[model samples]
Target: MKPLSTIVQAITGCLLIISCNHTPRARTVQVQSSANESVKDYPSHPKTAEELRQELAETEAADPAGMLLISGTMQENKILIQKPDLFHHSKYATDGYMISGIIRNKASIAPFKDAIVRVTFYTETRTELDHKDYPVYKYVLAQQVTPFELKVYPPESTKDFNMEVVSATAIRN
Candidate 1:
């Protein structure tokens, strides 16, 4: 019986060793590339300030409204709050300040979406009272103009407010 048990153990060990020594066969899987034919990769090169300025000028001229440029790489202060209408309103149920305005993307080609339009309320001494931000609609397409409305509940010392584009985020699909 002892010899039989030893033989069984040795057989189990040999089976384990055989299984462990087996190597998986290499697989020849075909991979598909996801490169788009319409998109081309251009080599990057450094340019002088004058060259950059000239290129910017050309871009600006080609698309004066800047509706077709790269949205993410646009420089700061490219968003313009055009013809903002700010006024204080008081009603029986609610009393606060109202801000309505149009935000325009001054980019040469980039479109902005989900832009944050901020209005900062201040007192007579320009003391910060309250600040509120309103988000622009779905897609403020390239060279596109979008309107925003915000109702701010100002503090008692609120006397005036200023509106500006806090930040504009570009939409990515």
Candidate 2:
């Protein structure tokens, strides 16, 4: 008979395998059936040329940092770890859910390599979840440019949890 800790380890490993699966399998997912049907009934209204330009200007003024372009599949893959690589994870109880992904800058730029990409996943309310509440929290570290996969972690429930990612600006100090 296997020990309790060993059985837990095996189960966690299985969860990791399952969560890392990116293949489009022939499975049925029950999408929300009550989506607002009126969305289709609404009359078509196209934005005029000037109106669209003004909207774009407004958006740019609001968000100066260009949005990160992440395709759906790429987004999923970006959450996986390498099939095999060195991984180190530890919980840091801070004001909120904070994550630091160290990446060596490959560009010719000098001081960029000394900088790191810091991502903090704070709750919508800006509250940080405790380490114990989240049984499975994966920390994925990959190259920002050509990230094939992210750090894979075991599957765990994260219902109603929302997270945002923001890369910190390089601190010259």
Candidate 3:
């Protein structure tokens, strides 16, 4: 048998040679689904400001009235008619009902113009009798309120009335 010191040295030299010959490579792991298929990860690209503006312009040009309609519908909830008062007045020898209220725009971004208020007339039993659309040709800024008074000739059986904003043109500047 070899001497103990020499045998230890020989073993150490062998281990150093083996370690120097072996190099580590990066390993890539791929996830697999239950169907034995590899799952791919896709990167998402977001729209830029210019692209969004172009798209909006195209949409507006395609359907101007439709765009207004959509915008009005989306903003209907944001428009509020507050402090409404219903009364009758003998003006111009006509018995007409007058509705006065404040139109409040709760939107924080867009100002509205040419808002239409729909006054729904109802009977004493809470049944709807008729509805009239009153055009308010006024500009109402965002987070602002405007006062409006409209004269309507509702049916004789109109005992109750409710007012709400039906449509408006959204001015995005």
Candidate 4:
């Protein structure tokens, strides 16, 4: 009888020979294209910024206040809050805190109005103290920026605050 090692080597050699002898067939795929097809026919490329702006303007001109509602995520993504200025009032009669910032509309096709800004107040230890939502009644055109302000009374422990555009009314017309 053949030794175990010899038998194993023979089996391995047979496998190697069999594998080496069997070759996979090469496949060539042919793609058909029409010479008459124009770039406009595909319409797969993205629109240019200028083209988008023009389209937005035309839509707005045709239908002002056509967009009644916009999603919160869409507003958060498109309406950006920039250059926030915070002020503290000494008198209690006036709201204790004032926040002013720029609302930039990054949406290519929709204008936004009446944005809801969410202010989250935090303590020195980074613990959240309170949050408030303020509405800014302003019209922000697409690719434009507008200023807004909010007055609120925050907890005395508030050491820092963050503001974000939570939602807005989109103007489709």
Using lDDT, give the best candidate's number: 4
Question: Can you write out model 3's per-residue Cα lDDT over 52-153, one digit (the tens) per residue?
Answer: 776665544343223222111111112233444476433233446556667776554456788777778899998999988879888776567777667677
Question: In model 4, where do residues sit more than 4 Å from their true spots?
Answer: 1-26, 29-95
Residue 43 in candidate 4 has what lDDT? 58
What CA RMSD would you report for each candidate? Answer: 17.0, 29.3, 13.0, 14.3
Candidate 2 RMSD to the real structure: 29.3
| lDDT-sorted candidate list, best first | 4, 3, 1, 2
Model 1 over residues 65-87: C-alpha lDDT tens digits?
23422211111122233434466
Model 2 lDDT tens row, 1-173: 46988999999999999988967879998876576554445537877987766665454333212322221120222322335336755433222222222233222221211112222233446554432221112222222432222232212332223222232232121
Report the poorest 10 consecutive residues by lDDT, candidate 4: 71-80
Off by over 4 Å in 2: 1-65, 72-145, 157-164, 170-173
lDDT, model 2, position 156: 33
In model 2, the clashing pairs are 80-150, 80-151, 81-150, 81-151, 81-152, 140-151
Total backbone collisions for each predicted model: 9, 6, 0, 2
- Ten contiguous residues with the weakest lDDT in model 3: 70-79
C-alpha lDDT values of all predictions: 0.59, 0.34, 0.65, 0.67
Give the per-residue lDDT digits (tens) of candidate 4, residues 1-173: 56998999999999999999999999999977798775456557899988888886666544433432232211111222344347642322332555666776665567777877777889999899998887889897877778766666778787777777677766655
Candidate 3 Cα deviation (angstroms), residue 92: 9.7
Candidate 3 lDDT for residue 134: 77
- When summed lDDT is taken over every stretch of 10 residues in candidate 2, the lowest stretch is 108-117
